[model samples]
Target: MEIPAPRRTRIQQEKRELILEAALEVFSTNGFRGSTIDQIAEAAGMSKPNLLYYFRRKEDIHETLMQRLLDTWLAPLRELDDIGDPLTELRSYIRRKLE
Candidate 1:
């Protein structure tokens, strides 16, 4: 059987946030295949080994960023005002999404 992962402390959470922010900036500029663990580590102001301590590989960072992007990007669609005229609401939703 697999053991559950330990809960992260506040410092761990903050470091993860730092890593994510750096990953986002690097990934946005370089795209996935073009970016490297060293690049992300440098951007985060941490060593590559430290980054790997938090996440095992580059793919882990990409996957986390994509999941976060999807959750945040789709939040606008979820909040469509159902009480309004459907067409108007949809147009607003589209506009918001585009923005």
Candidate 2:
């Protein structure tokens, strides 16, 4: 059996994160129909092929980012429960939003 090599540098990891962040910004601003791999690559300061290496397709990138956003949005709501007072819970929720 063969094993893949791990990424050798923190820079590569950072670059991947940058690419994802840029993709999210571009996709959010332009919507899926209007965004292109070239645009995302430019926004990420990377080549189209490099972007493709991280994400096989534009739809794949969009889906991954959307799922991430949904997870983030749902996390706070999940923290709310029936145990807290309404006004205090609302204030805590507002603070979480600002945070």
Candidate 3:
């Protein structure tokens, strides 16, 4: 049987998002190879140890960010349908992507 992930409290979820946003800024500016956990923690305004409570490694943060971006980028494509008018569907897809 598969183990389910632990559920997070509202504050925990908010902290995770904060970390992700900070990581994005760090990674974009420093690149993944140049970025450090200390940098990300500082950007997030949390201690390195506290950041570790949310993510064990820089790779984990990068992977999570990439996965979220990929999911968002593909969502509009997934909504496209042959049954829908092609022009209208294309316009809708463009709008979603822009947003």
Candidate 4:
């Protein structure tokens, strides 16, 4: 049987978000290969061990960020209609993405 994930308290959830944001900033400037857990933890204003308590590895942080980005980035495209005029649909899709 599969075990369920534990529920996080509000603070824990917030800390996780903080780590993800910090990771995103570091990865954006340094690229994933150049970024490190120390950098992300420092950016998040937390210690490396503390950050590790939330995400065990830099790869975990990157994967979470990419997954969130993909969900958000692809949502607008998924909304595009096959029935609408091609030009209008494209314009609407672009507008949704820009917004």
Candidate 5:
């Protein structure tokens, strides 16, 4: 029989975050073409099987990370409001990004 899978979305999200954080650190030093699942798993402090349980493949993780990165990368621009003072809004946007 197959083992039951984890149920909590929170748990899965946490583990996914761990994996992404680790992958980012590893990928920063070694480009995607040079990185591997083993490196990401070791950095994430989880076994290879455990990492795979959350992310099926390195490409999946990379794609997820890239999507999240793009979302955040555009957040400040998304916040721009024509109704707000240009300088003030720009300052607020820069502040948000710095934090």
Candidate 6:
């Protein structure tokens, strides 16, 4: 009988998330103008080629991360509607901003 390969566990997913988080931190701190793939790979504790595997290019990683951040930021704002009580809505907006 052939053995099947094991699927990734939650820990593996969490590690990937950690690597992405590290990449975002490094990118934000250095800015696109000053950052390099080597820097990100170092920050992520992965080799440059490994980082490239996760993200094809520096710009690709930056764009993907930035888009995810924008989507998250927009989600709460999109929930806001003009139909709600003004004060309550404003309060919720403030809370979301804080979040």
Among the numbered candidates, top TM-score falls to: 3
**Per-residue lDDT of 1-99 in model 6, one digit per residue for the tens?**
999966768966665576678778888898887888898889888888877756778888788788998998888878787899988988998899898
Question: Candidate 1 has which clashing residue pairs, if any?
Answer: none
Off by more than 4 A, model 1? 1-5, 80-85, 91-99
Query: Per-prediction count of colliding residue pairs?
Result: 0, 0, 0, 0, 0, 0
Q: What is the TM-score of each candidate against the true structure?
A: 0.75, 0.68, 0.87, 0.83, 0.72, 0.69
lDDT of 1 at 44: 99
Candidate 1 vs 5: which has more TM-score: 1
Of 1 and 3, the candidate ahead on lDDT is 3
**How close is each model in CA RMSD to the real structure?**
3.1, 3.9, 1.6, 1.8, 5.4, 5.9
Per residue, candidate 2 scores C-alpha lDDT tens digits across 3-74 of 997754887778778888998889889988999999999999989998888788988888877888899877
> What is the RMSD of candidate 3?
1.6
Supply the TM-score for candidate 2: 0.68
Q: What is the lDDT of residue 76 in candidate 4?
A: 93
**Which RMSD does model 6 reach against the true structure?**
5.9
Model 3 residue pairs with clashes: none
Best model number under lDDT: 3
Candidate 3 on 14-93: residue-level lDDT in tens?
99999999999999999999999999999999999999999999999999999999998998999999799999999999
Task: For each candidate in the order shown, give its overall lDDT on alpha carbons.
Answer: 0.93, 0.85, 0.96, 0.95, 0.94, 0.81
lDDT of 6 at 22: 78
Off by over 4 Å in 6: 1-12, 85-88
In candidate 4, what are the lDDT values of residues 1-99, reduced to their tens digit?
Answer: 999999999999999999999999999999999999999999999999999999999999999999998999999988988888999999998999899
- Estimate the lDDT of model 2: 0.85
Model 1, 8-91: lDDT tens per residue?
A: 999999999999999999999999999999999999999999999999999998999889889988998898987889999999
Which is the winner by TM-score between candidate 1 and candidate 6?
A: 1
TM-score (C-alpha) between model 4 and the true structure: 0.83
Among residues 3 or more apart in sequence or in different chains, the pairs in candidate 5 whose N, CA or C atoms overlap within 3 Å are: none
